[model samples]
Target: MKPASSSLFALAAAALHAALIALAINGLRAGQHNVPPRRPAQVQVQLLREQPKAAEKSPATPVQPEPLPQRPVHEHKPRTIPKPKPQPREQPAAPAKTPEAPAPTAQPSPDAAPAPARSNNTAPPAPAATAPAAPVKRGVFVDPTYLATETEKWYPRQAKRYGDQGTVLLHVTVSPAGRAEKVELKKGSGYPLLDTAAIDLAKSITYRPATLDGKPVSDSFNLPVTFQLHD
Candidate 1:
């Protein structure tokens, strides 16, 4: 190669190296002067727990005054009653007098008679014999025959089927209408069925009412009912 060409090449390389060094220095200076972006400040938050509020009281209602009673209106004037006329005075009458009776006179006594001799003659008439009065019927008003018939008619069918036989005595109160008012067991039968049947029969019985001066009256009497089983 020629000396001039080499010198020119060397000068161009030196100029290129100097330009690179200057660019590197400029980049370093720009990095040193540039500042980083500022970070935002951190804020501290404190949460507070709120307490629940109490319920508010409602307002009270105002009291109303009661209405006054209305007075009666006086449209017309009151009526005035007139005084009565005076009555005339009457004179009293005189009383009449009663007459007196006359007095009775006194009588004189007679003289005694003489005794006479005994003699046989007609005998004095004998007093007529009087028949004895019939005995007055009293006390028990019911007839025995009628009571027997009623007791037989009211015989219980159950007692007959079971062949139960007994006699029950009952005290019964009879009303004025001859109807039995109350019946109490004076003597119960041996069997309960017989006793119950007898009581029912006695209650249903009607008797002849007792009489006071021929008028009917209530009376109590002992009644007997026979519950006998017969073929």
Candidate 2:
């Protein structure tokens, strides 16, 4: 048989132990349900660096052309040309020897053989003087207005830049049809450039046919092609 007091004490101790175990079990369960598993943190990064090989390139070789052939040297001597011979000059014949005034001498016996048959000397007739040279017809016969159509150079606009503009007086012979047949520059602008231009311009221009007796006749007309520089 156990004492009452002791039994009561023992029962109380057992009840305390049971209460502590139940509390520890409840705490374990709460911790297991509330906590999540731990995982490792991760991070990513990039690095930048230069690549030198990508920029490199090789050099190319240059091309050359073939050389030209050299010329051969010559040793032949140069030839000398001969000058033409001058002709000999002729001497003037002695002036016709006049008869020596019948050498005053004593003549007798058949009159000295009849005076040696007196020579009948005939003289050549005088040459007629050449008629005064017909005055060379001198003048121009081309219409300037029409001449402009033939040569644009006739315009002093181009010649004026070089101080070449002036009048060209000329002699012209026109056919019955007023066409310039013969044209000559009697007086020029002192410039061959202008003179040639006027001559060329006149050659192409035509004029109204001239009439002497109500009928068209080839006649000469003098005219001047004036070249002036003006705005």
Q: Note the residue pairs that clash in candidate 1.
A: none
* Model 2 lDDT per residue over 93-180, tens place: 8899777776677658774565566567968799999887644432334455566555455664557778666788878887877678
Candidate 2 regions off by >4 Å?
1-153, 156-158
Model 1 spans with C-alpha error above 4 angstroms = 1-137
Local distance difference test, each candidate: 0.74, 0.69
Model 2 scores worst on lDDT over the 10 consecutive residues at 40-49
Q: For model 2, what is the alpha-carbon lDDT of residue 196? A: 83
Clashing pairs in 2: 138-171, 139-170, 139-171, 139-172, 139-222, 140-222
Among these predictions, the greatest lDDT belongs to 1
The most accurate candidate by TM-score is 1
